[model samples]
Target: MIIHFYNILYAFYENKDIINKVNIGGIIVKNYIIIFAIEAGLTIIYALFSGLNLLNFLNGTFTVSMIGLCIGLFMMMYSDGAYSIMGHSFRKFNYMMAPKRIKETMDEDPDFNKKLRIRQEKYIWTNPILFVSLGLVIISLIAMYSMV
Candidate 1:
């Protein structure tokens, strides 16, 4: 799994689009470390603020864990093509396309599911922010269990 992950990331970095977006400092701080710091600070501060007492603070750990887990989970879901398909909303609003292309009598992309799967695999490996959230989730879960 780790090897496959590395291969996917290697291919991603080799891409022209991602290569343009990456820099040494931006990759380290802006993309990865800074996000973790932000998530940690937000969760910890919220826990402290809402749970001033010891027992309440322990209770807040659950909230913290849930938040981290939810963020990580949602990212995974989105990468697997959640909002990519406007679906019912597109039909109702007809805004994803004008009335012309929307009414075209053509079948959907036959390879859409295959492309979606490939995209999801790439995203799971290439997205450092998702890993940061997963890390935060693990930390929060540990804290919650250890405190109890």
Candidate 2:
């Protein structure tokens, strides 16, 4: 689950810049199809093992499935766009408010600062979504357990 969440976040963040540059709509459609396949597989497994009536389970799962599908789809389509826009806006605001560029001192040691900035940017892009997804997955597991 952790790995899957990371993959999702990575895919979102890495593609963010390219999203505006390329065919994001097509990418999002492909992502939805992949998710739909996974959901279908899960439905089949649940039907086979849970002794739940297929039609009844589908009825109950439909709404939750749609919610999950939409979340997944939107995350794929716009997560990066959302993050990049927010990040850019905040950086612009900070630049306007700052006394000077903090990198002036680091200019003499450009490589070190460049590496640190790269690491920081990667973490900043990934951490929030990871933590949020972790929370959601935990809640989902708890809910599933309660149902059982």
Candidate 3:
């Protein structure tokens, strides 16, 4: 059973697209690291405002964050290859997972302009989202300090 499981996972790991994405840090690593860093920073900031002295807060946050980070990373790694866990190659999984409607639409439409427009629309909200997150972080920090 263990050998079979290893073989299945190995197949997914060896897939060209999966290997390329994993190696280039495109599919998950970079984005997941940024997300985890933001969450960990917020956790530390919240801990700091919990009334513990700096040293205690630092120590507590470090301990808690390390454990939480390990667990979080493990879960992310496990989920990154959903198909591998179910005994399917990543390439096959991705092909199967793609939306049929989107594929058909793209196939029927040869215009590159529509695709470019969709891509641009996706990026339009990035600035607003970042600003909102920054505002929320600042407000939380101020509120936490006010409590002290």
Candidate 4:
């Protein structure tokens, strides 16, 4: 019975259309907060393992800002990479999994997939807002460090 339930769950995720829709819905929900938590945990572990006084580290404005900068950059990198790989993978999966009519139309117009692919690929590299925000954070971190 347990094996049967697992198979049913696996089958649902294995369906490309369902998975793509789910991924689309998750774009907003799946974001930097999750990465920040993971990075924070790692940062805490590093601080502890390195024999740093946690209170002193946390009390330093520069140290706190630098940690935030690191987490933000790491999240940006992760989000960009995932977007790049998943966008391409989604297109391929769509081509393979689309219904008969859609697949026929897609085949009739070779450029259809290509055009959609270019748009999706553009997001991975052309996020000005993310870059500007990260830049501001880094600048603030540097300013704080200089003041210290």
lDDT string, candidate 2, 36-78, tens digits: 4555566566566656774535533453454554555555545
lDDT of 1 by residue, 2-61 (tens): 765564477577773443443443343345655556665765787678876654554554
Better of 1 and 2 by TM-score: 1
Ranking by TM-score: 1, 2, 4, 3
**Over the full model, what C-alpha lDDT does candidate 2 score relative to the true structure?**
0.48
List per-prediction Cα lDDT, in the order shown: 0.55, 0.48, 0.48, 0.51
Prediction 4 TM-score vs. true = 0.30
Worst 10-residue lDDT window for candidate 2 reads 116-125
Output the lDDT of residue 46, model 1.
73
Candidate 4 yields a Cα-based lDDT of: 0.51
Q: Write the per-residue lDDT of candidate 4 for residues 68-139, one digit (tens) a residue.
A: 556556556665566556677888798888999988898898566543332222343223334334544465
Candidate 1 local Cα displacement, residue 108, angstroms: 15
Clashes of each: 0, 0, 0, 0
Give the runs in model 4 whose Cα sits over 4 Å from its true position.
Answer: 1-67, 74-81, 108-111, 114-148
Number of the top TM-score candidate: 1
